[model samples]
Target: MPRIRKNPTGVDPQLLVKDAAKLMPAPTRRLFLRGGASLGALAFLTGCDIVDSASAEHVLMKISYFNDRAQAWLFNPNKLAPTYPDSAVRRPFPFNAYYPEEDAPEVDKEDYKLEVGGMVDNKKSWTLDELYALPQETQITRLICVEGWSAIGKWTGTPLREFLRRVGADTRAKYVWFRCAEGYSTSIDMPTALHPQTQMTFKFDGEILPRKYGFPMKVRMPTKLGFKNPKHVMEMAVTDKYLGGYWEDQGYNWFSGI
Candidate 1:
C-alpha cells in the first residue's frame, strides 16, 4: 500500500513570479523568462524544481497558470478550502531535493519518550499515557511555510505552555529546546514557544499524527517558519543560551515569520 499523504502547504508560483517581475525592469524580466525556461526544462529532466531558483521563477509562473486554473494556487488565502470533514490531508508535491532521513517515530515511539529536563525543578520523561492525562486542547490552525504554501488542519494535544507549566519551567528558562528522533533538534523562544496555538499534537484531522508526518510529536507554531516546526520530537529542554535550529545554521532565518 502507498504511504498515506499528509501535510500539504506551498506558495503560488505564478503570483510569486508576477510579484518578482514587477520588481525588475522590462529588460530584466525578459532575461529571467529565458533563464526560467532553461531551468524549468532542466527541472523536468532531473525531477527537481529548484535545480536553479534564480532561473525557474518564470517556469513556476507558468506552472502557476495550471495551478491557478485548478484553484489551488496558494500564498495567503482569502479563504481556505472547506476542511475535508474528509480526514487525511494530502502531502504537497515536494519540488526541492533536500530530503532529510531519520528513524521513523513509530517503530519505537514509546522507547524514546519526551524527556523534560534542564533548568527545571522536576526533570522527567513523559509517556503517552501521562501526556494524554493532561487537559487536552483541540484547535484548527493554518500551517504557513517559508516557501509560500499554506494549509489548514485540526490538531489535538497538550499545549506546550501547559506542559511547561505542569512540569514547572524555571525562572531562568527562556527557550524550549526540542530534540527529535533523528538526533536532530531545534529551539524556540518563550513567547512563541508557549504560544496559545502551539501544541505537542497527538492527532491530525481526528487521527494519529502518522509516521511520515511526525508520528510521536512535532511542534506547530503559528508565528514562525515551517522548518521551526521540527518533527519526531523526543526531548524538551528549558534553557537560556541561543540554541540555533537546523535551518538557521544553514543561513535560513531563525525567526522565519510572516
Candidate 2:
C-alpha cells in the first residue's frame, strides 16, 4: 500500500494559504484573499479532499478555473502589452519549444499552405506569398514564458484581427485554435485572438523567420504566456467548442494570461 499524506505540510493552515496564494497571479490572488477565506473552506468549496493525488488535482483544477474567470473578468481587450524600444530588442531571441532547437520541423516554403476553417465564411487555404501580401505591421514586444524568463523581439506580421476580418471570421466565437507543423497546438479566447496586438508573424528581425524560431509562421500573442504562442502553424480554426490545448489538457490553465 502507498502512504498518503494527511496534511499538505506540517505548517499551519493560515500559513499554507498564505504560501499557496503566491501560486496565483498578483491580481487574482488579491481578489481571492479579499474574503479572507480559510484554506479548509476553500478546499471544501472546490469539493475535493486533500488526501490524495486525484483529490488534490480536483482542487487545483478548481483553483485554475477560478483564476481563469478572474483574469477573464479583468482582461481589457483594448489594453496592449508593453512594447519595448528597438534598442532593447534581445539579439538572438531564445528559441523555445517542447522539442530541441535542432529538431524543429522544416517547412517547405514552396509547398506550405495555411489551412483556415471553422466559423469562417472563407475556408480557403493560403500560401505564404498570399499571406505575405496582406497588410503588414511590426511590434517590439516581450515574450513572457511560464518558465520564468522573457525576451524582447521585433516581430513583423499581419494583425490577426485584420486577417480574420478579411476571412470573414465569426468574431463573436468563443475560441481560436491553432495546430502547428511540429505537433503542438494551443487555443486562445476570442478576445485575445482579436486583440490588436495578436499577430500572425512571418518575419523576425527584418528577415524571414528562421527555422529555430518558427520558419513558415507563428501566432504571436503578447498578452498570453509564451507557450500560448504556437509556432510553425499549419492550421487554424475558430470555434465555440472548448478545444483544449496541449499544455492545458495536461494541467496548465486554459486561459494562461500573463
Candidate 3:
C-alpha cells in the first residue's frame, strides 16, 4: 500500500466504521457500545479470580472499546484478548487491493511475477497464472497485527513447502526469508515453513490482498505476529545459515514464536 497522508479507512464516520468493523454478535455490540454494562457483568463474574478487580475491569472494557469499532480486534490472552466471535469472521467473498488514495501505485501488468531461488535447483520466476496453476491449498487464519488488534481471514494459496520441493530445495535449507514491496520483510524456520497450514499466500478473504494489507502478494504467518507477514512480496530464498531477517536486524527476536 502507498504511504498516503489521509487515514486509509476514510474520514467519514460511517465509512470508517464499515471498513474497520467485522460484524459481531448483537449482544456483544450492545455491551460494548453501551459502554460498561456487559464489561461490568463480566468483571463481576471473573473478579474473584483476578489479581485486582478494579484494574481488571478497566482493562477488559478498554480492549473492546479502545479503537474505532472496526479495523481490527484483540484477544491476546497474555494481554486482554479482544476477540471477534467466529460468526463475525465469515468471509463474504475475496478481498481486494485497498488503495488509500487515488495516486497509489497501480499494478501495471497482468503477469505479476514472483522470484523463488537460493539454495534450490530450479530457481525460477512465476507469473500470477503460473502460481495459480500450482496445487492450491486453503485455510482460515488469524491476522494478528502488532498494534494489538486481529482479524480471522480465509486464505487460499500454494504451500511454500510445495514450492520448495518444486524448486528442489536442499535438505539443509533451515530457514526462509522474504522481501516485500512495502519495505518490510520477515523470516521463519523450515519447520514453520513446512507446517500444514502455512502458505505463499495469493488470495485473502477469497479476494486478492488489499494494499494496506499488502496487495499483489504478502507473506501470511498465521501462528505468528503481523509484522512477520511481509506484504508486497518480491523474492524468497532458502538458507542453511541464519541471516537475520528485516525485523530481527531492527531489534525483534529472529525466533519470534507465537
Q: Global CA lDDT of candidate 2, please?
A: 0.82
- Strongest candidate by lDDT: 2
Instruction: Judging by TM-score against the true structure, name the best candidate.
Output: 2
* Cα lDDT of model 1 by residue, 1-258, tens digit: 112232121233333344234344434533434455776788798898765455565565556445433432232323322333334443441222123222233435445567888877778788767876878777666666666777666767877878878888874466788876655577876766666767888776667777656766777766555678877777888999768666454334555544
Local error of candidate 2 at residue 94 (angstroms): 0.8
Candidates, ranked, TM-score: 2, 1, 3
lDDT of each: 0.61, 0.82, 0.59
Per-candidate RMSD vs. true structure? 13.0, 11.3, 11.7
After superposition, the stretches of candidate 2 with alpha carbons farther than 4 Å from their true spots are 1-51
TM-score of each: 0.61, 0.81, 0.59
Ranking by lDDT: 2, 1, 3
Tell me the RMSD of model 3 versus the true structure: 11.7
Residue 46 displacement (Å), model 2? 16
